[model samples]
Target: MLTEVKERLHSLGISVSSEPSNVDEVIIKFSIEKVTNHIKNQTNLSEIPTGLKEIAIDMVVGEYLFSKKSMGLLNIDSLDFGLIEKQVQDGDTNVTFAVEASSTPEAQFNAFIQYLRHDEVDFIRYRVLIW
Candidate 1:
């Protein structure tokens, strides 16, 4: 999965070093300023695939630390969106989504990074929606 993320980033001319601690997180190190600059100068949020919003939001909320478990629950399997759910606490619509590692690691990882270089809107949208 790391290899694929690296490859995709490379294909887009983005560079970063990723280190995984435990099964749930990947720490990416690079100049986020540069990436954001590139995003601003280059891509458009509308270009991101339809289903990537939640995963992208998770990446932002996690602060560039990708959650393997949350991603596993969100990704499609065998052309299916698959099953996943979010739990919202009383008086708040903000949800806490959780999951264990499943069989769709690569798909989830790919989707998570699909819009990573686009813009900060994904993060902002998440914060606005949550609050």
Candidate 2:
């Protein structure tokens, strides 16, 4: 999952670097200046795939960054648009996406995968197709 995110972000021209400098202590780091800038620039996260407006709200993104229990985002109930629910069970966080009726599945999935590719949601797995 992390690998896919890394690839996606990289392909999108977003810089994501990692460090596993030590053999005994392994710590992977995903650094992105654009993300910070996006937040600092006060860019609104829209619900549309690949659209700035689709990105989660700044506050929510910050909360996810602070939330340590993120498991994955989306599920069978995640097919819909407009309403994306967050759940944490047994210290695991999962994101359930509910796209609006107007949103296309591809657009939703693209936006979602991009978000999951971000440094915040570490582990992600989804089967239900949005498109």
Q: What is the lDDT of candidate 2?
A: 0.37
Query: Which run of 10 residues does model 2 get worst, by summed lDDT?
Result: 23-32
In candidate 2, how many Å is residue 23 off? 18
Please give, for residues 5-123, the per-residue lDDT of candidate 1 as tens digits.
Answer: 45544553444444365322344333233333333333344333444534433333333433333445322233333443435577855766545455364555455455443455544
Q: Which candidate comes out best when scored by TM-score? A: 1
List candidate 1 stretches off by more than 4 Å: 1-29, 43-103, 119-131
Positional deviation of 39 in candidate 1, in angstroms?
3.5
Return the top candidate by lDDT.
1
- Model 2 CA deviation exceeding 4 Å by range: 21-131
Q: What does candidate 2's lDDT look like per residue over 5-78, in tens digits?
A: 34544553434346546311121122233343444334332222233322323323323322222434223133
What does candidate 1 score in Cα RMSD to the true structure? 13.7
- The CA lDDT of each predicted structure is 0.41, 0.37
